[model samples]
Target: MNDTPGWASPGSAPSDGQDATVPRPSEPADSGGASSKWSAAQPPAGQWSPPSGPDGTPAPAPGPAAGWGGPSHTGGPGHNGPHHGWGAPPAAKPGVIPLRPLGIGEILDGAVSTLRAHWRAVLSVTLVVAVVSQIGDILVQRYLLPAPVEVDPNASPSEALDQAADSAKASLVALAPSLAITLIGTLFTTAILTVVISRSVLGRPVTLSDAWREARPRLPQLLGLTLLLPLISVAITMVGIGPGLLIGSAGGVALTFLGGTAAVVVAIWLMIRFSLASPALMLERQGVIASMRRSAKLVHNAWWRVFGVQAITLLLTFLVSLVIGIPFGIIAMAVDGDGLGGLLSGSSPEFGWPYLIISGIGAVIASAITYPISAGVTALLYVDQRIRREALDLELARAAGVPGYGSDRPGHGPTGG
Candidate 1:
């Protein structure tokens, strides 16, 4: 049996311990009608060797290639070469996923599986973060944020235009503090949940405190990465639209529209490219810049796959939020008394403490469920990419103490630290 690290073929479906019979190559069979019997021809040794290492050293060939070309095809009980009719071992499943290149379904399932396995720790982190965020948002909306601007239907066109501008400005102002709160909350939850997910990958149970302890030192770097990415996107957008705004003519309107669309496209591309940086940063202990570079490297040929996973996850979370929030919203409006009337009359709803508290509970519940899934997917995607490109499954197998992959020897485990 070839037990070397990289011997397994990429994208091999995990087997179920049954002997998988491989068809013989197009060689003539004996009169007995058995395809297992091989011809007596032999091939040169170096012709079918594994690729050379970076240092120009040849990787060790995995024994005699019996079923293919290099001799040893006696088909006896003692034959130990790469023969047909023997089932390849399944990929090691020491944790939430098999230690192999993951498909989209596996990745999604792995994330949900982590949440299911470590619900206490994962939910604790997300719940606290969500509650704090919602509280801050509620307070900011109630006290600091200006009321929604009401547009008068009886007003002139200029007045309506002015009202629309004011409404936009007010909306921005109202959203700023909420966004800030959410960002900070997301930062903390990402750091802690990342630690939990990393441990979960190794099939290790983790406590909330243990995860927090491991993740605390990386918080500042994580914050930097989180803030830096948005800043970069904003800078790109400003640059794209700045020229048109400076010109400020009728043609500039068209230019601004085009430039803004282009900028948004670029921003989305860059964001998807850097999406894996958080898990890279948290798991690899990389700097913000180094993590971004690592993410770019990992995502180079997999942009659309990564983007598709992220988009699907985003849609799922959105749906979850909508499903959970609608009931709470209606209840809040009913309880608050004024919000229902405002909704019926097609105006901005005035939210009081009763409405805010009820709605905040729904937001908390939605966030608690969604946060872990999002973070888990990102972390698992990082693991999946590394396994595909770098044979990280071998290392993971060893770390997870799978029997055949040299688990008895001392080695570095996959860890967030």
Candidate 2:
């Protein structure tokens, strides 16, 4: 790995901290039905030996190694056959997560573990971003956004329809500024947190300064990726609903509904496919397009799995936000002197500074807690996918200074006589 916390593309040369003498093996070709896809220099089953020394002898065990797959792992000692004893050894866990394919629960736990273990750095990064985002939101709400559109229940049908249209437009207008602020905030937070989580995986310590220094160079590419995804989704949506919208008739409305649903399905599939792009960009030093392509490749065989984990994360975060926000929301209403009457009557309350400030606090707290989990899952998912597909745990072990994995640093490795 690089000092800045990155890995080389799969099947490529080792990165900065990896030993150059230990070359990575090329991956098998995908689904070509030709035996040539398999490497010709094959060891017989259960006869694979670990890397040998200069004398062509199997290197001695590197003194009491730990973790799954033994100390010198190339898919563990059991790679070629089933375990014959008390089962496989536990995977090496130098950091927040085990250095192997991760379970969903493990992925979620790993994110939370990083936050707990490095609360200061994680919270510092998140709190700052959330506070700034909320401040912009409060300012926008207070002075810039238009008041909610008032529709009279007694208005004629045509008048009511007009009011509804006006309301929709107003809602979009109000949402625009806040969403923009959120996008910018997420960009910064994701970049920084990725570095933090990556370090944590190696069981290494990191500070906010370290994370920022590592992440700063990649911010532009991250931003471009962030902006591009939404635009792509929007373009897909417009393409789906455009014709129906143009017709402006009841039939057109039905067509729009059908088209929009299909478009949403496609958009969602694409989003899940590209979900790992941000981390790929941040960690691989990849460009915007390259990172996206990398993500698509990683997600290729695991679309539903990725979608399921992401959905669970989304649901959990939403629940957490609601739990944290509701009390603050109620208090804000009480403090703002609006009471619950508006809520009971299905009407919007006019919020004052007290309400905005109090609610903003809730938003900040919720965001501070949720950001790490969200970003961590994405980064770890990227790691997990690579581990599954490319046998990246070996590289991670080397980078983490695990014995018997072979180290690049002089004093870190066992010296051969």
- lDDT (C-alpha, whole model) for all candidates: 0.76, 0.81
Model 1 TM-score on a 0 to 1 scale: 0.77
Return model 2's CA RMSD, one decimal.
8.6
Worst 10 residues of 1 by lDDT: 71-80
Residue 400's C-alpha lDDT in candidate 1?
A: 70
Candidate 2 similarity to native, TM-score: 0.81
Runs of candidate 2 with Cα error greater than 4 angstroms are 10-87, 152-164, 339-341, 344-346, 407-417
Per-residue CA lDDT of model 2 for 1-417, tens digit only, reads: 464457544435222233343434346676456566667888789997698999999898775435434543333211321222234566688999987778899999999999999999999989999999999999999999998898899997657656865897899899999989999999998999999998898898899999999999999999999999999998999899888767766677678889999999999999999999999899888999988888987787689999999999999999999999999998998887764556666778667899999999999999999999999999999988777655567777877777656655443321211
lDDT for model 1: 0.76
C-alpha positional error of residue 4 in candidate 1 after TM-score superposition, expressed in Å: 24
Q: Any runs in candidate 1 off by more than 4 Å, and if so which? A: 1-86, 150-166, 407-417
